[model samples]
Target chain A: MRYLRLYLHFLRFSFSRAMEFRLDFFFKIIMDCMFYVVNLGFYKILFLTTPMLAGWSEDQTMVFVSSYLLVDALHMTVFASNMWMIPFSINRGDLDSYLTRPVSTLFFVSLRDFAANSFINLLMAIGIFAYTLMNLKAPYTTGQLLFYVGCILNGWLLHYVLQMIFIIPVFWTQSSRGFSDFFFSMGVAIERPDLVYRGVLRWLLTLVLPFALIVSFPARLFFGPETPHLFLHLVFVTLAAWGFMLWFWKKGLRAYSSASS
Target chain B: MSWPARVVSTELRKILAYRSDFWVNFLGQTIIQLFIARALWQSIFESNGQTEIGGFTLSQMTLYYLLAPLTIKILMGENIGFFSREIYDGGLNRYLVWPLPPIGYKLLTYLTYSAFYTAQLALLYTFARFFLDDRPYELSEFLRLIAGLGYILVAAIGYFCMMCLCELVAFWADNTWSLGVMLRFVAGFLGGTFLPLSFYPETLREIIQYLPFAAFISGPVNLILGRSTPMEALQSFVVMLVWLPILGLAVRALWKKGNLQYTGVGM
Candidate 1:
């Protein structure tokens, strides 16, 4: 209840702040819509050339794209600004304020600024996801969809954890960007369907690095059998990833020598 | 060194100092994009048993993907923030006081980066000549490759003008970064970076062919691949030439208005 109250405060403050830059608010909507349009158009044109991509039909691909868009919109709304500011917070010693607060530093840092600008975009993404899932040929129970939604939320959490893993290096490297560039390069896997990747790349994206687990795993399982294998795998990976994130965050904080404040 | 030479030298040094960021952002992005494209296209071709789609064989498509990255690198360049950072931080005041033309200096900095990318384009074309094992580019194609570079230089300058117009909005708006983002998104689609304009409907393709975006990505790639001739590349250049003068005037007018509005206290 305390954390929820703190989050509500954050949402209130962020909305008030967003109202200051009215042009930026509108521009954010346009920018995100352009991105969504391009993503949908790219697949639309590709599907015209070939009926199937990675054994998934146009509608199935739409589901995958919409799911990724939802995940992205959720991230943008909640975590993206926080993660983007981490390097600066570390570099400028501003994180000391976060550390001194009574709240959990991780919670405060990750959730302080609710992106009210992206809330509308998030709604648009959810609409796309819903529209794509409608008139579906694939047979799945509401229980299955609830399960898939649970996995997708886990996928979003895993995305956060993975990004934090890349960003925690700012405590030492102080390289301005840390290792975030490499993280983004690998993030391409999150946009693409998992089956197109073959052999070692498949193993790498799915198992060791596990970027595909962010969206593809959830989408694939939605269409596939209601097997516990993938669900258990996702739950295990996400829990382990969160555990690693907490451990790494502690280690990074220990290593941090605060810069000029 | 002369003023222009000194500016170029400093930009080159900056590139060397942050070469890691350059590799990760530019080359890393290009490699991953090509990897995904290759995997996706290969699957489509294999499943459908179609060796060619939209006049591009698998090999030609690979070459397109390769060349397209170079075109993008030249256009986007190494500076992610570029001029907007200077304006936002009020560092533009320093350049304004300099006895040289500010726009000229900035343009020179932009082309220096493009020149480096242009050299990379040549090297890649040469590498493709020998190692595109299934169908190597012949010597005649190499001549066309030189002609194609001329068109690409035009595209780089053309895009620089467009971006300047975007960034110049910073004078009035607190954050003009979104304009740049919007420009890049539009360029990615309409410029044929994500999907070739050839794949669009006939009317759309024909209209976009006259637009600088298609000439930016597809025109140069097609010319080097022998899918287009120097004549066609020249025609694209002519189209770009029409947009150039108009963009130049807008940029000039904005800089003048911006200078008048400048309080020089970083807003």
Candidate 2:
């Protein structure tokens, strides 16, 4: 119960702090939107010359793109902001305050960075997704919809865990900048449909790194509603990745010596 | 006795002092570009089988992508708008009092860093060339490639100077990073750094081709690919000449105007 209160306080603090930077908040929305718009334009051009891309129809591709945007926005808002703050907090020993709190240190760090501005992008993604679905003449069944929502949540957990695995190394690496860039770049894998990759790289994305699961699996639920097994596999992969990252985070904390010394 | 060479040598040694970090950053950037290009090329190939994209063969497109990181390394500075940092931190005050004219100082500093970056790009390009799956050009074509590289460098400098002109807004806007971010985003789209303008609709491509932003990447890429002749290169060069003087004048006027409004404290 006490931990709950502490988490809420951190959440409130994050909300208030984000509100203070109104221009930054709007800029964040615009930046995310512009990036998606460019991707959309690329798809438009790609489809202009060809009616289909890699067996995915124009509307199906649009859904995939929207899902990619939604996942990216969620990752940026929930996990990335917190992960980015970790290195700075550790370096400045500001992390000590969070460490000593009654709540879990992980909870404190992650919950303290709920970027409300990214909600704008999230909303835009949903609008686009809905619009594209209508255009495609696809109807969402209740079961399929439930599975999609579950997969999205699971994907978010998977994303947060993988981000933690990448970020936890900052304790030992001392500078997280390279790792941060790498993490973000790795996240770029989700921006494209999993179908684009082939052979060894495809296997790695599907099994090992499992980044494709972040978007492709949930997106598959919508696009290929008949393939429920893929959604279950995605959930299983998410769980495995979450387990690995949690273990790594604990190991990293043991290695962390406060930068103050 | 060349001014650029004089400036570059002094800058190279200073950068070399932190050589390990610099090399790591360069290597990391290169790897990222490689993978991204790999992903993009795979998609393009899958979409169109052996067909020309924007007049580029599959091999040519791969080469274009391979060359992108090197071009970015050569032409790009530490920051797109370092002038903003100068203005915000009162570093401009020091430049103001310098014996060299303000434009001369900006030009020299730009050259200094650019030369260091050029060496870095050359090293990386050589490394990429060995490993890259592309055919080498004939000797004559290779020489023309070098000339193309020179044109690209000059054009890049022209664009950077224009950005410096925009950074003069910092004299009014103060310390927000958004101005720089916004400008870089604009350039990323309009400059064909994100996606080549050739991929855009013909009407849109035509508009972008004449814009200052197109000179940043597409013009040079076309020049190297032999899409443009020597006369065409000369015309592009003349366009840059027109832009450089105009932007230089704008920067000077803004500097003088901004200086009048300068509170200097906290800015």
Q: Identify the candidate with maximal TM-score.
A: 1
B156-221, model 2: which lDDT tens digit per residue?
Answer: 677566667667767766344555556555666666665666677889877766667666666666
List lDDT for all candidates, in order: 0.82, 0.68
Q: Give the per-residue lDDT of model 1 (tens digit) for B51-77.
A: 889988776787787788678778875
* Candidate 2, A1-261: lDDT as tens digits: 876776577668877887876756666677777777876776787676666665678888887787677777777766667777887786666777877876678887886777777777778877886777677756678787676767777777787877777677667656634265556556657766777777776787788888888877777667673465786688688878878877887886777676631
TM-score of each: 0.93, 0.84
Given the true complex, what DockQ would model 1 score?
0.58
User: Which runs of model 1 end up more than 4 angstroms from their true locations?
Assistant: B78-80
In model 1, what are the clashing residue pairs, if there are any?
Answer: none
TM-score of chain A of 1: 0.96
Give every collision pair in model 2.
none
